[model samples]
Target: MSSASTVAKKKQTPQNTLSLHYLGDRVLRQPTKRISKINQSVRDLAQEMVQTMYAEQGIGLAAPQVGVNKQMLVIDCDPNNTATPPLVLINPEIQTYSPELATGEEGCLSIPGVYLDVVRPEAVQVKFRDESGRPQKMKASGLLARVIQHELDHLHGVLFVDRVRNDLVLTEALNKQGFSAKAVQPIKS
Candidate 1:
């Protein structure tokens, strides 16, 4: 292997750990910029995001959630398995989605303890760049699909709470969790 490749691989430790930006923070609302290049720095950030996700016991997280306004996210549905690696998506785009919709209980690391019911497509096809900067595409379903859609929303400055159909329940849950309901920018379907 090339020395550069070896160096990049060795730098994959969790040293660049970032703090989460909570709801009501303008950083979370600002749209993320597309990554022009996936270099070592970007890879390190992804590694740190993975560490933070595991530390927070979250299945998914976005760059904006970590106060980074870049189109990136990390997800690992099965955190218990060390053999399965976390998926790092850079400049991800949902190419298509299944017409069939399903409701799933969703939550955000940014919002902390608040969870709400969200309706989304049962399946999705997404295109993105891998950590190695290679173009990649895949179809996702079940928990993986739900987490992808949720994390992708963060790139567009959207939150899962925005998709909640019941305002009262959402507001109650947010309030109970010490979060403000006003922070949610609900998308009217």
Candidate 2:
């Protein structure tokens, strides 16, 4: 797998790149399949995903957001910092979550222009395969942890809006963004 640093961290709006699937798109709701084999194709996808994320000015992106049904995601919380490398996770599994929760504003590439406060574990321990297919375990917190959890949700056909607690705010936000509230499949706690 090529190093993520090889891709330019600076945001660019490239034409003909992967198009993001919107909230109401069926592709965003479809569950992704675990990658059985990681190869050049997978690495290529990861690279492109990173590019697409940068193009969209997003901090994280899941394969489902680009109409791909694969358990893969790319994240770069600090896109402007060339020193920081982007992350590519394949078949990520969260092993544990911190009992303490934090509430923060969350947004999705699939659900454009709708940001809402959502509560999630402040920290998480996760296992996944890197771009090179090597097993990796990581403990993430703060924005990185939030981004990981949000992207992981996409792999399971779940969006952050589903985790939102206040129906009125969610409805208002969705409506303001021109997305129908009916499209959201709320997750009952």
Candidate 3:
């Protein structure tokens, strides 16, 4: 690599480049103790997660998606999916789920704008590590379910689009059902 490239890579914070959303360069983060104090470590991961999420124009992102194959993730539900209290799920595990199912338009930072109608539990109970590495569980419904399910799917190496439709025409019909992707171009190959 060139000297400038090396400097740029070194200068990259956890957020990464505002232009590179795939976070492909990031690697797996180590798991922390449930009771261990993870203020600095959590903060670093959170900052990087948000930076990567915003750079991709996504509402939420998981650590594994960016190559940090940990149980962590971040979510923002704004048009940019950038919310004030970004949901940080470290070592997150879905504990419960509603019997009700919902199909929502979903996409991925890793996969770009290709979208489809995917079915998921409309409500979910998730147990995960907090920013401090403490374990916590919460029941989520509505958009929260959608977000959590999307990230959790990543943990299993599943893409939201994969669960949804691959047929563009079917995808269009699903979008009419309120599954809108508003795709952005993938930054990495």
All models: lDDT?
Answer: 0.84, 0.88, 0.59
Off by over 4 Å in 2: 1-13
What tens digits encode model 3's per-residue C-alpha lDDT throughout 35-82? 234567656766677766766667778766665645666766653321
Query: TM-score rank, highest first?
Result: 2, 1, 3
* Candidate 1, superposed: residue stretches over 4 Å from native: 1-16
TM-score: which is higher, 1 or 3?
A: 1
Candidate 3 lDDT at 143 equals 85
Best by TM-score: 2
Clashing pairs in 1: none
Clashing pairs in 3: 14-48, 59-81, 71-91, 76-81, 78-81, 96-125, 105-179
TM-score of 1: 0.91
Q: Comparing candidate 1 with candidate 3, which one achieves the higher lDDT? A: 1
Report the lDDT tens digits of candidate 1 across residue range 125-156: 99998888888888998899999999999999
Can you write out model 2's per-residue Cα lDDT over 1-189, one digit (the tens) per residue?
Answer: 224433334445564268899988998888999999988888888888888998888999999999899999899999888778888889999999999999999999888899999999999998998877778888999999999999999999999999999999999999998999999999998
Summed backbone clashes in each candidate are: 0, 0, 7
**TM-scores, each model vs. reference:** 0.91, 0.93, 0.66
